[model samples]
Each structure stands twice: as C-alpha cells, then as structure tokens.
Target: MMARDPIRLWLNAHLGLVYVFLYVPILVLIALSFNKSGLPTAWTGFSTEWYGKLVANPKILSAAGNSLIVAVASTIISTVIGTLLAMGLEEGRSNPWLDALVAAPMIIPDIVLAIALLSFYTLLNMSLGLHSIVLSHAVFNIAFVCMVVRTRLKNFDRSIVEASIDLGASELTTFRRVTLPVIAPGVVAAALLSFTLSIDEFIIAYFTAGAGQGSTTFPMQIYAMIRFGVTPEINAIATIVIGFSFFLVLLSQRLNREAAP
Candidate 1:
C-alpha cells in the first residue's frame, strides 16, 4: 500500500465540508417540497401534492412559458453572436481593453446591468415585454458565451483552419466543416450555460419586463410568491428550478471537460 498524504487528506476533508455547506440546504429544500406536513422543522410524510398544484397553477404555467421563451431566444442569439465575436477576437491581435469590454457584462453586478438596460430601453421608448427580457438576457449571455468559447479557442490549432482555407474552401465552409466541429463542445456548453442563466435570472427580467402579468418570468413569479411566505407549492417550484439549473451546469461542465486538450 502507498503511504497516505496528509495534504491530500486535508484537502479532501475541506472539499467535503464545502460541498456539504453548499448543498445541504438545497437537499433539505427538496425533501421539504414533498413533506405532507408542509412545515419547515417537521416532516409528517412524503406527498407530491405540491407538484400537482404547481401544474394546476395558471400563473406559474404562464410565467414558466415566458421564461422558456426568453431562455431559448437569448441562448440562440447569444450563442451565434458570441461565437462569431470570439472567433473574430481570436483571429485578431490581443487587446486587453477590448477583452475587458467584451467581458464587462459578466463582471458587472446584475442589478447595475438591469438598471442600465431599463434606462436604455426607456430612452429608446422600446416596449418592454418578453422580447425585452430576451434582449437584456442576451447581453450577459453573449458575454458568458464569448468567454467560454474564447477559452476553447486559446488551445485551438490554427493550422487546421489555414489548411482548410488553402484547400480552396471558402471561409464560411471552412468554419462549418472544420472550425465549428473543433469548437462544437464549447459552443454547446456556452449555449447551455446561457439558457440556464436566462431561465433563473430575476433582476434583469424584473426591470426589463413590461408592466403586466404577461411579461412575468418564472423567477419574477417566484419572487412575488415568496412575498406571501413559503408554501409546499413554492418549495416544489424552487426544487424544479434548482434541479434544472443544476442539470444544465453539470452538462456544461461535462462538455467543457470533453473539449479540454
């Protein structure tokens, strides 16, 4: 048997504590979602009635639909724009200021970005709705996607691109056949990350959404519900949302690992 390393053991213990700290509350929440008692400290029994209520709630259904629309639309737009932007920047000389500008949205606080977006929209007299939320989400999503793709590009082999071009293939065709395949994993990861963030986003959506029930995203709806205090139904909704975000992030991590050299 090999000798045990004290440092490794210590690190493992620390990591275990960190995971417990982060996920114990979420695990408790999940358990409580099905609690028949619907009490925080006591668990009478397990029941899925709250989940059924979630399905029957019209307001929640509408808000979920709105979130899906914003997430899908923003993911598509951000993935395309961000991928192209990352490619452009990678092909050009490095500029620190330009890099910072590209990443500013992700670095800045969400509330600040939300307020700025709201101001910009009001100044332009743009009608606020799901579309507005989509646009605002796309702003941060683009930055995140760009950052992820850029990491993939950092280790990219330029020779493949040059070879494809030298074979009389047009730039677009080369990108479709060669460049895109190499970066496909990163693109997928970025898209998933964007979708997850957009779906869970509250502040930006709250600020940019129109003044009506029609524009309420799921997170916004959850916030409104929270004002009335937590219930089994709210717990169920939170569990579902947290589960979805966790899944997407896990998938993104997997993709990123696959893309690693």
Candidate 2:
C-alpha cells in the first residue's frame, strides 16, 4: 500500500475545515427545519410540522407567488437581451468602453443602483410594483446572463457560421438554424442562473418594491421574519430556498459543462 504524503494530508485537512466552515451553518439550518420543538436549541424530535406550516402560511404563499412572477419576467427579458448582446459584442472587434459599460451593472453597488433606480422611477412618476421590481432585477440579471453566454461564445466555432452564410443562407437563417442550436445550452444555463439570482435578490427588491405587500417577494418575507426572530417555519422556508438555489446553480453548471464539448 502507498503511504499518503504529509503535504497532501495537511492540504486535505485544511480543505475539509474550509468546507465545514462554509456549510456547517447551512447544514444546521436544514436539520433544524425538521425540529418538532420549533426552537434552535432543542431538537426534541424530527417532524414535518414546520414544512406544513410553511405551506399553510398565506403571506408566505403570496410572497412566493410574487417572486415567481418577478423571476420569470426578469429571466425572459434578461435571457433575450443578454444573449443578443453577447452575440453582437463577440461578432465585433473588442471595444473597451462597450465592455466596461456592459459589465457596470455587475460591479456597481446593489444598494446604489437600487436607490438610483428608485429615484428615477419617482422622478418619472412610474408606479412601483411588480413591473418596477422586474426591471430592477433585470439590470443585474442581464449582466450575469451576458457573461455566461459570452463565455460559451468565446469557445464557439465561427467557421460554421461563415460556412452557412457562404452556402447561401441569410444571416438571420444562419443564426437561427446554426448558431442558436450550438448555444442553446448556454442560453438555458444563463436563464436558470438569472432566475435564481432574481428570486433571491433582496436589497434591490426592497428598495424598488415600494409601499405594499402586493409586491412583496419571498426574500423580502424572509428578511422580515428574520428581523422579527427565527422560527421553525422560517427554517423550513430557508431550507427550501437554499435547496432551490443549489439545484438551479448545479443545473447551470451542468449545462455549461455539456455546452463545452
């Protein structure tokens, strides 16, 4: 039997510690979701009471519905615009200003953007509701979607597109039948990632959601619950949100990997 190297053993130990440090709290939260006592300190026994309560909570249900609406709307807008932007930018020679402008949303402080957007809406007298939230979410979602699609496009074979054009296909036809199919996986990945981000976003949504429960999203509800205090139901909801985000991100990663080769 081969002996393990000391350096490798040490590195493995450190990596394990890092992983525990990052995920221990999440694991605890998930475990607590099944607690019968509804207290973090005492687990009493495992039960699905919290999950049942989560489903029965009208406020939570309403907020979740609103979040779904915002996520779907933002994902659709972001995917379409972001994919087109990536294709347009990639087709042309690199322009530093354009690149910076495209990336600005991802880098800018969320709070700052949120406030600026809120102020702009107020100035224009635009009503604050689902539409405003969708628009606000789309700004960052577009940046993320564009970045993901652009990464896929960077490895794209442009020769195929040129060949299609050379073979008497119009540019639109070539893009539709040839280029799009190749990038479909990347598009799906980007849309999923954008939807996840939009669903979980709070700071921007809080600022832009304006005055009412009508536009309250799931994250906003979570924030309110956290502020009041932690409860078993909150734990269950958190577990669900975390699980959904993880699933979407994993799917995105898988799609991107599949698109690669």
Candidate 3:
C-alpha cells in the first residue's frame, strides 16, 4: 500500500471544507423546505404544505409552463444543430477558427451574451417573448450539446464508417444503421443536458423576456420571489428545481458513460 502523505491529507481536508462550504447552503435550503411553519429558522414539523402551495400558485404555474415551452423548443433546436455540427467537425477537416467560433457561446460571460442578444433583438425590432428566450437559450445549449456529442464521437471507430462504405452502403444508410446507433446515447445525453441548461438559464431569458407576464419563466419568477424574501414555498420550489437538474445531469452522465468504452 502507498503511504499517506501529509501534504495529500492537508489538500483533501481543504477540498472537503470547500465542498461543504459550497453545498451547506443547498442542504439547509432543502431541509427548510420541509418546515411546517414555512420559516427558515423555525421548523415546527415536517410537512409538504409549501409544495402544495407552490402547485396552487397561478403565477408560478404560468412561469413553469413558459419555461417548459422554452426548454423543449431550445432542446430540439440545439440537439439537432449541435449533433450535426459535432458530426461535421469529427468527419470533416478541422478549422481552428470555426472551432473557436462554435465554442465562444460556452466561453462567453452570460451577462455579456445576454446583453448582446438583447441588443441584437432590439436592433432587429424582434418581439421579445418566449420565442426570443428559446432562441437565446439555444445559442449556449448548442455549444454544450456539441461538446458532449463530440466527446462520444472522439472514441468512435472511423474504421466502421470505412467498412460500411466498403460494403457499398450509402452514406445515409451507413449513418442510419451504424453511426446513429453508436451516437444515440450521446444524443440523448446532449438533449437532457440542453433541456436542463435551458430550464436553469436566467440572464438571457430575463433580458429577452420583454414586458409581458406571458413570457415569464420559472427562473425569472424565482428571482422575483427572492428579491422579496426567502419563504418556505421558495425553498420547496428551489428543492424541486435542484432535484430536476440533478436528475437530468445524472441521466446525462450515465448515458455518456454508456457511450464510452
């Protein structure tokens, strides 16, 4: 057995502390969501009253509906475009500039992108609403989806494509029969990832949501609630959102692992 180094022990201790610091608030929020009193500091008993309240809130429900529309639309657009981009980059000659351009959405600051998109929409006189949010969310979602699919593609065997061609299979036939099956898991992972990101996105949505209650998304609604005060209902909503995001991320990770060796 390797000896435990003192430096390694110290590093691990610091890392543990960092993780605790990061997740302690989330743990507290989740725990508070079960409080019967709906107060953060006081927990009379365990209850799901706040969750029920969240369900009954029309504004929250409306926002959730808008969020679902945007997430679904963005996921569909991002997954298709991103998968094609990944395939093109993987099969065709690499262009450094093109790669950089594709990656810019992922690398750029959210506020910067949000403002830029808002400005562009304004200049184009585009009506800002759920559609605008969908378009904006797709910009980054596409990059994320492409990156995920590209990871799966990296481990792909090019010889399979060559073998298909050698067998006189058309490109479309080979892609449908072989390439698609190989990449299906990656596609699912990418779609889940895109959906999660679109659901959680706020800055761009806020900027492009325009002056209507019709386009308000769940994240924007949550932000509005947060500005007022933290309530047990907010905690419950947050817990649900966190759980949903966690589930999607776990699903994506599992699919990605399956797509790997």
Candidate 4:
C-alpha cells in the first residue's frame, strides 16, 4: 500500500478532536443522568430514576406545559406570517436593505433582541404573560421561517400559480389549492424549526414572561434550577429537551432537503 499523506492524517486527527470536543461533554452528561447514585464523580449503576422523578415534579410539568403552549402558538403564528412574507419577498425584486431588515432578528444578539422586546412591551404597556411571550417568540421566529420558506420558493415555478389563476381559480383558491400543496413540506419544516426554537429559548422568555410561576417556561425552570447546582434531575430534563430539539431540527433539515428542486 502507498504511504498515507501526512497532511491528510493531520486533517483527520484535527476533525476527530473537533468532534470529541463538541460531543464528549454531552455524552458524559447523558451517562451521568442515568447514574443510580446521581453523582457525577461515581456511577453506581444505570437507572431511569432521574427521568421518573421529573414526571412526578409538578413545577417541571407546569413549566413544560407553558413551553408547549408558547411553542405551539408561536409556531402557528410565525409559520403563517413568515410563509406569506417569504412569498412576497421571493416573488419581488431583491433589495439589500429589505433583505437586511428581514434578517435583523436572526443576525442580532439574542440578548439585544430580548432587551428590545422587553422595552417595546414596556413602551406599549402590554401585560407580561404567556401571551406576550408567544408574541415575542413569534416575532423572533418569523424571520427564520421566512428564510427557510424562501429557500423552498427559490426553486418554485410561478407559472403554475399563474396557470391556476387563469384556469378560473380565484387567487385565494389558487393559493389554498395549488401553491400551498407544493410548498407544504417547507412550511412544515419551518414550523418544526420555529417550534424547536421557541421551546429552547430562554433570554427572551425570561425578559418577557410575567413575574410568576404561571408564565415560567421549561428553559426558565432549567435556569432557575441550575443556579444552585447541576443535579441529575436537571440532567434528565436537559437530556429530554436536547433529544426533542434534535429530533425537530433533524426533521426540519430532512424536509428542507427533500423540498429542494
């Protein structure tokens, strides 16, 4: 066999190190979550006790419910608005300024966006609760949904829409029947992504949520718990969240790829 290139060997080693750096901590955390003794330093044996405890915890359950409420509401609102915005943007001539404006939320620091939303709510004197959080999340997620849908739209044929209209279908009917069917995969992908983002978001929810347990989301609960120390309970909760978010992101990625021309 020919000798392996030194550069290729070095590059492969570098890639392996990068993967280890990124995933080894996550692997450790997952393992410790199943530790029967619930000690990071020592693993007594494998057990599902930590996850069972999470189910019995009322606070965690309530926060999880609130997160679900916010995620579902925000995803629906954002998907509708963002999909429409994507259609408008994609169908129109591209403008650098307009594109920048649409992408601002995605590019801006999360802390900055959270602060801005809090300030805007204060300015409007809006009541802070799950509703406010839903709106704020929708605002943040809309741009992301639009971006994804626009990618799908990039390969779409507008002639089909025109043909449908010419065939005596009203614009609303055409959109509902013709255009909507073609882009359903992308819409679903965007909605899944929006839901995932809303579920894991913390800074914005913290800033916008009311000062009560009623509005507390899962991420906020996690933050509250982690302030004291890292517990097996926290690890279990994090593992569940991570698994859910990963599933959604992967599903979205798959749908997006399939929607491509």
RMSD of each: 1.9, 1.9, 1.5, 1.6
**How do all models score by TM-score?**
0.95, 0.96, 0.95, 0.96
lDDT of 2: 0.94
Give lDDT per model, in order.
Answer: 0.94, 0.94, 0.94, 0.94
Measured by TM-score, the strongest candidate is 4
What TM-score does candidate 1 reach?
0.95
How many angstroms is residue 165 displaced in model 1 relative to the true structure, after the best TM-score fit?
Answer: 1.7
Candidate 3 has a TM-score of 0.95
- Across residues 1-261, which tens digit of lDDT does each residue of candidate 3 receive? 246687789899999999999999999999999999957768899999999998899999999999999999999999999999999998888889999999999999999999999999989999989999999999979999999999999999989999999999999999999999999999999999999999999998999899778999999999999997899989999999999999999999999999996
lDDT of 2 by residue, 43-102 (tens): 899899889888899999999999999999999999999999999999899999999999
Ranking of predictions according to TM-score: 4, 2, 3, 1
lDDT of 2 at 47: 95
Per-residue alpha-carbon lDDT of candidate 1 for residues 1-261, written as tens digits (9 for 90 to 100) = 245687788889999999999999999999999989866547899899989989999999999999999999999999999999999999899999999999999999999999999999999999999999999999989999999999999999999989999999999999999999999999999999999999999999999997999999999999999998888778899999999999999999999999988
Number of clashing pairs, model 2? 0
**Candidate 4 TM-score to native:** 0.96
* Superposed Cα RMSD, model 4: 1.6
Better of 3 and 4 by lDDT: 4
C-alpha lDDT of residue 88 in model 2: 91
